[model samples]
Target chain A: MKKLPEWHRIRIIDNPVIRQALVIAGIIYLFWSMSSLDIDWVRVGKGFPRAANILAHMFPPDFSRWQLLLRGTIESVQMALAASFFGMILAIPVGICGATNLAPKPIYLAARAVIILSRTFHEIIIAIFFVKIFGFGPVAGVLTLTVASTSFISKMLAEDIENMPSGQLEAVRATGAGFFQFLNYCISPQALPRYLGVSIYRLDANIRHSTVVGIVGAGGIGQVLAASFSRYDYDFSMAILLTIMSLVFLGEFFSNWVRSQLR
Target chain B: MSIILKITDLTKTYPTGTKALEGVSFTVDKPQVVAIIGPSGAGKSTLIRCINRLVEASSGEVLLGNTDILSLNSRQLRRARRQMGMIFQEYNLVERLTVMENLLSGRLGYVGFWTSYRRKFSKKDFADAFELLERVGLSGYQNTRADALSGGERQRVGISRALMQQPDLLLVDEPTASLDPKTSRQIMRLIVELAHERGMPALVNIHDVGLAQAFCDRIIGLTAGKIVFDGSTRQITEQVLTDIYGEEDWSSTIRKIEEENEVGAE
Candidate 1:
């Protein structure tokens, strides 16, 4: 066997740059650990009785507010559906613009900037802003969810489009496929399944977010839950929490079923 | 025959300062199969791609018919590209699409976007596509997803898609590079037969010397981004092969079959 060349030999480095980075990271972790100092064993131990007392009062979920709860649940579902539908439709164009293959450099950069800005804030935060601008109710919640969903769906869709095989696109271009035709024949087919998957996932996420955005006076079950919490009605809060959990679980199940059907 | 495509002093230089094509020039008349053969990175692929403006030339003109293709706007370039069909080495079919859809993609240039979006091709285009599929021996596999097809089958689809365009010129870049020996021959024969049947000029970039010599009417040997030899198959002697490949050893590999044939005759 021939001897290996000196240039090909592996070597380990003991460098100051790596050591400095590790020291900085360790100091930051220490700072975080020091700031996490608000746990009181005695207070928690005493609070358990109060929690149990409240739980005892929450018997059978207080069906006196059944009509209100029913109305709120319906409104929440409607907000989620409207937001998801419009957001997904808008995401198609934004996602294409952000895709490196389809759009020119400037367009991709601009679309990516918009997606980043939209996703930076939580849906609840965006809902609060929209509530101030558009006034409270389902409209604000719908708008907030739409913006958040568009950001998430467009980002994922753009990534899916970017990762598609360039060979197919090149072949389509060689055939003299125009912009829309190239998208229709080459890009859409390759990215459709992934795009659908991301949209379904985003719909599930938006449903959960929509329920919470209503807590900030945007309308839905969240407003009622917040009102109950404010009145110190822990039992009512627990009931609402359970209902929200059930709704989220059902949404997840439905989303999974839809994804399977699409596949 | 009229000159269908002409290249004048074409040059392509990458951003990294590597020159892919260096003042290469050629004229391809109608109804001819011109094979470009060379070692890897010898500008054979670049030369073919430049013809269709897939890889834009840094300088010089590629005149297709009467128009200077390099000077055309995006719309005009697209219109010109519809007349030229390309086949790739990897058989770049949209894997998720059906083979029938892949063939129909060739007609996308002519069909309106809305119509193509609905996958509603005209009756004439559909009949032509089915005929081409039958010609390429993939009649029953039209509904098969491109991903599910074998390598040869995918390449067959690729060829059929090119034929679907009813193009004036066909450009094939290493069509048989990824196939086994037998399949390579079959692909070459199909390409030749299809080109002959259509009576269109076919510019094929091939790495295999035997395949090129057997299938092509004329062979243009490119080396270091320039055409070193341009002549008929009979003119591709050992000296010319040595000049193109830059090695005498390749001549031995090429001559071994002839030597065996002579021995068998004895």
Candidate 2:
């Protein structure tokens, strides 16, 4: 065989010398950082006693205030339900508008910008902002989760719409269906199963987020957990945490049931 | 002959600067079934789509009946498109929808969004859809989802959806590309028979010369974005086939297919 050409011989990963140097540098940095930061093992040992005390107080989780805990949990679920409902409704239009294949360039760009902006901030931060605007209550929690729901659901939905096969869409348009009319038939049916799946996922995530937002004085079970913790009522805090976990599990079971029923 | 579609100096250049069609001109007259045959990427699809203004032409005039399709506004384009029924190569049905819903989608142009959303199809339209399913040999599959159907079966549904439009002209793009040869012939025969019965003109884009010759009244051959031949199927000589597909070994290709068929039979 003839000698190989320069390009054929030159692979990016063929530079073993540079690769070895990078690995050595990474190892050196890891050891150096560990040495520079002095960690006191005895001081860390003290944290265990406080943890043990809190654990000791958490036994048999007080349910005397069961009615109050149940009310807060119901509020959180209601917030998630309201948010998921409106978010999915609004997301359908927004997602379709943002899909690069479905909408004009400017409209797609604008919709994308809105989705990105909503996603940039965490739900807690959004809740704080809504609390300032709408005043602290379940209203703020609902608004925060609704905005969060739109960001995730709309972005994923837009991606789904974008990734869809163009042949069916073209066939629909060929028969004289307008853009909105096309959505009612082709996009609606094609995206329904996946859309329902994503919506259920968002609903589950929103419920979890709603619990956390309550710590910031947005209404939910998290507020109850935070208040109980601050008052040294670890048993009540344990009860709230268990309730939140149970809620999450229930949502998961429901979402799976809905997915199974789609076909 | 009365001309239903007239193309004048039609051209299409994609944004990437690929010239899919040159200044090509052809007219589809009356209820004649015409076939567009060419090698892959030789502008057969572009030529077929340009008539319906599906692929926007860079420069041209496409007259559907008397109205210049390219000159129509968005509203008028929708009206024009309603008169043209399209069949896809992949049998492009909305996969999750029931067959009846897919069939009713053909009337989406005539009905508004809300009417179609509620499935308020007129009694006659619903009746016609049922009749069409039977005509396409898929009567019992009305409630079945499109994704559940086989390739040939889906194409039959594709045919039903197009016919339900009660289109004046059929725009077929490779109706049998994915089907087995026997099914391919059956589909072509069904399409031709349906068009003949309705007196609807049809422009079919096909890759197989043999299939085109078998079903179509007139054949238009394209090479490198230009029409090299346009005539009756009887006039398509072996030399013309070679010219269209660029040195294609037609005899050998046919022999290989025959050999495959013999193996399949065995």
Q: Pick the TM-score winner.
A: 2
- Model 1 per-residue lDDT tens digits across residues A1-263: 99986664443546769878888999999878766866677898999998788888776576567787778888888888898889899999999999998899999999999999998887778888999998979999889989988888999899988888878988999888889899889988888888888888888887788779989989888888888878977766777887889989999999899899885
lDDT of 2 at A217: 83
* Runs with alpha carbons beyond 4 Å of true place in candidate 1: A1-46, B256-266
Docking class of 1: medium
Restricting to chain A, the TM-score for each candidate equals: 0.82, 0.89
lDDT of 2 by residue, A163-262 (tens): 9999998999998998888988889888888899999988888888889999988898888888999999999888888999999999888888887888
Model 1 chain B: which ten-residue window has the lowest total lDDT? B252-261
Scanning candidate 1 chain A in windows of ten residues, the lowest lDDT window is A5-14
What is the lDDT, from 0 to 100, of the residue A18 in candidate 1?
89
TM-score, one value per model? 0.91, 0.91
